[model samples]
Target: MLIWRLQKRVLNFVHVPPPHCGVDIVDAIYKCLKECGLKNKVFTVSMDNASYNHSCLRFLREIFSRNRRLLCKGKLFHVRCCAHILNLLVQDGLGEIGHIIENVRESVKYINQYEARKQTFSKIVQQLQLGTKKLVIIDFPTRWNSTFQMLLCALKFKDVFPRFQGRKPNYDYLSTPEEWKNVEKVCEVLEVFNVVTNIIFDSDYPTSNFYLSEIYRVKEILNLKAMDESDFIRRMVGKMKGKFDKYWGECNLLMVVASVMDPRCKLRLAEMFFPKIYSEAETRNNIEQVRGDLYQLYMSM
Candidate 1:
């Protein structure tokens, strides 16, 4: 397990025994913080959405709740990693059209795996004078961002594929025109998620304040795409929305406070978007709740 400080610098990489139960993780974390003399200074621990990690965080929160130095009474101490949540959202959407994606994957692999076929595709690219020098990229199934990137690069070779098909009579892996259209739609939707992931995962920057706005943007984009006329996009958005709601339906107060504290946003940001995201009564109540929480946080500090 790796611990990171406020400046995004690695504090420690602790080696723990295997089996990775919640108890094991909590013990590892506790020892690390104690050795570093930062046990009581810990405000939050960001982690991926693994069941074991959730349990580990709950255990840690229970410990921190008794510490006088900690704020929020440890309530906001377990932050679900935003990048991981974005990954889950994209992966859920991709599941709806797995066959189509697999066909594209196979087609990209067929072209890039053999020297002769790769050279043939290169010649086609040269003849067509495509702007990019990037060849077809095959994505790992586990990483949805890579899949988005693969579709993006493959879409650039759309015209070259038909010509390549004529040269290789046995090339049955070629994506059909409709499949290409679906890939295009998928790319458009995933692009938003990809951008947000990049922003959140920037190692050199503080991304906490940006989290609320980026998440709000993602929800807005998905909601708009959910209303699209195409059935494929609508269905995909339905699945994506389920994952989104599971993770983000209730905005985390820590993230809300972070955004509210940003000089660029502050409370105005919440006031401007609350009505669109919640009912009038809910928005009013949320604003009051956030105000109270913010006051509590300030008093604690």
Candidate 2:
């Protein structure tokens, strides 16, 4: 495991054993923090969405809650990894059109599997003068974002595929026009997720404040697509919305307060966005509640 000290610009890597139970994981973290003289100074721990990790965090929080010197009383101590949640959301959406994606996947695998086929594809690219030597990318089924990239790269060589198929009449996995259109639509949605993931995973900067705006943007985009005229897009986005709401409908208050703390946004941003996301009454109540949370945070500091 790795621990980062943002202010001091230090990163520490510690060796941990396998078969990590909740108690074992929490004990490792506690011992590491105590050794570094930061057990009481920790305010939050960010981890992926695994059941064991959740239990480990809960155990750690319980331990810290018994300590009198800990500030914030461990109220904001567990942050679910945003990138993992984004991956889950996109994966769920991909399931809506899994068969279409599998067709594309198989075609890519066929083209890249043999050296002779790759050579033939290269000749086609040269004959068409596509002006680049980029090859089709084969995506792993488990990685949805990689699949998006494979489709994106495949689209660039869309014109060459038909001619190549003509030369090899036995290859029948070529995508039809409608299938290509579906790929394009799926790429459009996944691209937004790709950009957000890149922004959040930047190692050089703090990204906590960006969570509110980025997630709000995703929710708005999904809502707009849910109203799309295309039945396929609407159905796909509906599934995505269900997964998104399952994880993010009730986001952590610390992230909300962090957004409000931004000087350019302040409370106005919350006031503007809450109404769009919540009911009239709930909007008013949530905004007031966030204000109270912010006040308490300031006083505690």
Candidate 3:
């Protein structure tokens, strides 16, 4: 479900995530909207009845109350995310875990709540500085929490957490064997999303970062060329070859998945998930020799 926000000719979209940062279409829409105008595009606001907070109705209520003009169906609108609805089924019986999870969550939170403890912990960490960086910062702190939690509950206070002996429970009682496994899953999914977010935040993150190091993992998995194809796809893809095998196939299936944050060309980029060449591809004199049959198909067509 989505909140289809419109203000005169200007439209704004926003979302809350579930079933894993799931609103992945807005990327393609933003990319596509430029060449084509968005005046004719129809909006579907993602919604879910189970989530009363971020629902389409709540979105409408908030906006329409602020400005009656938004009430018009021709302009701003709201819809629910089907994936969220599907997730209701996925999390159904598991709702009981929320309270239990919260209890454990608070237990972990208690440690981080005190600044002195956090500082002491940081000092301890600096002593163990195996990496140049102390933490991996993410938009969502789930992984960070898990890492910190294990450090606190299990490993930290083992013989009194201050001892800092081993890796287990080093976070606290927060991360469990179960949570560690889930953390891996969250990392995998979040890693894909972080890549997508980078592409979506192209203006901010810049494609240059993507040309270097593990940062290229997303571009490699998404098999995306910059909106301008500024990066070397063949070379970058070669470098990131096996690093992305985990999410590569999934991205091929879900390139259309983007956020409602920027819907411009996301849909069109979704089309690029397949091998179709853009009509505007520059044709070089050497195209015939380099492309052979591929060139023949284009020329014949």
- Local distance difference test, per candidate? 0.84, 0.81, 0.35
TM-scores for all candidates: the values are: 0.93, 0.90, 0.31
Q: What TM-score does prediction 2 earn? A: 0.90
| lDDT (Cα, tens digit) per residue for candidate 3, span 143-190 | 333433333333222222333323334454444555444333333423
Which ranges of candidate 3 are over 4 A from the true structure?
A: 1-104, 130-174, 193-301
The best candidate by TM-score is 1
Every candidate's CA RMSD: 3.6, 3.7, 15.5
Model 2: weakest 10-residue lDDT segment is 2-11
Error of 1 at 76 (Å): 1.7
Q: Give the winner by lDDT.
A: 1
Model 2 residue 23 distance off true place after TM-score fit, in angstroms? 1.3
Better of 1 and 3 by lDDT: 1
